[model samples]
Each structure stands twice: as C-alpha cells, then as structure tokens.
Target: MFAKLKQRWQDTRTIMKLSLDAEQRALREGQQHPGAEHYTLAALDLPDGSARRVFARIGADPEAYRAALANRHTAALSAIGLAAANANVTPAGASSAADGLAPPAEPTLLFDAQPSGQTLMQSLPELQRRLPAPLCGAHVLLAAAAMAHSAAGRAFKAIDIDLQALGSAAEAELRAAIPS
Candidate 1:
C-alpha cells in the first residue's frame, strides 16, 4: 500500500510537470503573458469557486481581477474589525467607513509592527525567508494533483486559452511573478 501511494505521488508530480511545461510552451510559442498563464493555472489549481470567479474575470482583464480580489480582501478585513468591536474586543486603532474621518498616518507602521523611537527596531529575518525547499520542489507535483482533480479542465471554469505569436507580454508576467 505504501509503495502504491508513493507511486501515485510520483505520477502526480509528473503530470504537474507536463502541464506546466505545456503552459510554458504555449506561452513562448503562442505569445502569451506568463503571469497571466501562471495566474490562470493558479486559478485552476484552487479548490474554491471564488477563485474560479476571480480567474474568469482575470481572463477577460487581468488588472480588473487583481483589483477585485484586493478590494474583497480589504472589505473582509474591515468586516472582521466591526465584528470584533461588537464583541467588545477593542480592536486597536481600527476605523470604520462610517467615521467619515481621514485615514490615519500611522496605520501602515502599526500593521508592519515597527517600533517607535523609544524601542529598538528589530527585523524578523524569518519573515523574509523563502518558502520551504521541499515545498518549492513539489510545485509540479501539486499542479499535477490539481489537474487530476479536474480543476485544470474547462469544466472547472471558462478561460481564454489562446496561444499564438510571441510577444513582450510573457516576459512582463515572468518579471512580475519572479522577484529579482
């Protein structure tokens, strides 16, 4: 049974590698943006309908999808703050839209956990550390599993998968996704 499971895992990894390879080839030969492809693939890998919606919108206009997702997260966080207030949790320095007040200057600093003048500023090196090596190595494997789960197929979501004519778009997406 253990051997079977290991073989299954290996097979999944192989499938993910093939999918990524195909996507990359399509991007290179078809003149598609790699970031768009990455996000499109990422959407397929996700297990939620919300991600499907975001990816669908992204396929139409990448910028619009990015903004919509950001706005949704912001609204969710704001709602959490309001709920905490109702529970008498005394959320620190959180403001609601109803306040009709200007944005606080120190909000960013507070969120970043920076210290004041009296306290020595310390860096959390761990925060800057890349994801685990094993996790990174298993990327293709995860992608394969997602594909096998039928997440990568058209049945999952509708996306424009046109691959043709190489352009600067793929390079731009690669630059955006991979930090220099």
Candidate 2:
C-alpha cells in the first residue's frame, strides 16, 4: 500500500511540476507562501501554453503582471506602515539566528501552516474528476481562478481582469490542446 501510494504521489507530482516550481519560487522570493498569484505567474512562465495565449489576447505581459503584483504588495505593506523591502529580505529556509546574526528588525508576514500549494493540491482531485489528464497550464489557471478570494483573484479584479472568462478560455484552450 505504501508503495502504491508513493507511486500515486509521484505521478501527481509529474502532473503538477510547473505549479510546484512556482510555489518554490514564491518561497524563495520571500513570500510566506504560494498563492493564486504565484500560480498564475508560474503558468505564465511556461514555455508555451494556453495561459500565455490568454494573457496575450488580453494584452497583458508577464513582466507587467509581475510589476503590478509587486506594486500591490508594496502598497498594502505601506498602508500598514511596513516596508515592502523587508518582505523578501531573507532567503527562504535561512534563519538569522543560524548565521549568528540578530533577528530581523521588523516582524515578517505571518502565514498559516497551510501553504497555497496545499490548497492547490487539495483542489486537484476535483479537477482530475472534471478534466482530462496530463494536467496542463490551463488546468492550473482554472484552479487558481477558482480560488476567488485569493490574493491573485483580488489583484485580477483590481486590474479589471475577468476570472470567469479567463477560466472559460483556459478550458477551451485545454480542449484544443488535447488530441481528439
């Protein structure tokens, strides 16, 4: 049973590598955890896919999206009298104490134990039930959009992007990408 479970997990990892990579990148960049924004960013970074095409159709450049996200984060932090520069000051998994240095001058963003990757992973079984396999970029986009209350969703709304329409377009792209 353990072996079977391990195999299943590995298969899932293979299908979700891009999304997972995004989550890792977010952590490395000093995000407390990955969120819908991270997922979307990852999808955009794919070499070629539905997510990229969708952004292109909307005249949204990946760099511009990243800048917007950073600006939003900075604005939110500034409103609370916190500095955005400190948000990503420390590398992921590195502790100041471990380096014999004093603790950070400011408190870091507090995050729940459950990261966005877990949330995305939890959504996958349902997605697998509804969508065909070899989960592609479009699948990640749809999943991210489903997280309507996530930071990415709010950011999209602020920018006048339509999540529902984006999801529909992703689904169509996924269908087109698959061999009939």
Off by over 4 Å in 2: 1-16, 57-59, 87-116
Which ranges of candidate 1 are over 4 A from the true structure?
Answer: 1-11, 14-41, 44-59, 82-180
Cα lDDT tens digits, model 2, 89-164, are: 4332222332343332322333232355567656766775576544556677778777768766676666677888
Candidate 2 lands at a TM-score of 0.68
Which candidate number would show the highest TM-score if scored against the true structure? 2
What residue pairs clash in candidate 2, if any at all? none
Please give the RMSD to the true structure for each candidate, in Å: 19.2, 6.8
